[model samples]
Target: MGKIPKNRDEALWTLAEWNLSKPEWQHFYSPQLKSDMMIRIAKEWKLDGVMLHYNRGCEGLSLGIAENRLAIAKAGIPVMTFEGNMGDEREFDEARTMDRIDAFMETMGLKRELLHA
Candidate 1:
């Protein structure tokens, strides 16, 4: 009645088409694609480390994230993950995220240098 068609028959067909067309975790997908993409990006940019934000709010985007982390590590890239919600501020923990980031930087042999005037 709101977004769908007023007719039940038409609504059924529209909903089916929408569900079938979704490329999310509902469909057959290869995690290797995301793994390969991360690997290529790291190599291309010569990145010292990769930080993956596990957005709790977005299930579709985070589907292959764990596998991607493993694959990136296997490919000899330093990677780390932090969990938080991208859309909701209440779901994010600033202190915990900062701690994980600090650990990641330390693992990468990175240290903050104090700026002097």
Candidate 2:
């Protein structure tokens, strides 16, 4: 098949493989790796930021967004999340989403210019 990652430990494995040392694995095997790998990839591609859908219905998935947010923030990246159902626009509050986004961006200094630029 395609080229496999040289480090198998970094490859996505079962949840059992993810243990108390997950952060250690990330730091050693792939320092670039994070819970927000998708957002990190988008940022590496020079995108402005990442918008995560924090679905209220998906409790398991949404539970880790806060940790992911913290990790992404440590990487000097911006993330904005909105609370809503997967396919129900009626449940999406635009104003609240905008408020969160604005606050996140501000906190990340996304609106600031580079000191040298």
In the order shown, what is each candidate's alpha-carbon RMSD?
9.9, 8.8
The 10-residue segment with the lowest total lDDT in model 1: 20-29
Q: If scored against the real structure, what TM-score would every candidate get?
A: 0.71, 0.50
Q: What lDDT score belongs to each candidate, Candidate 1 first?
A: 0.78, 0.62
Compared with the true structure, what per-residue lDDT tens digits does model 1 show for residues 1-117?
A: 247587989889888756654445332365776677678879999999899989888877788889989999999999999998888989988999887887778777766441111
| Prediction 1 global C-alpha lDDT | 0.78
Candidate 2: regions farther than 4 A off: 1-36, 102-117
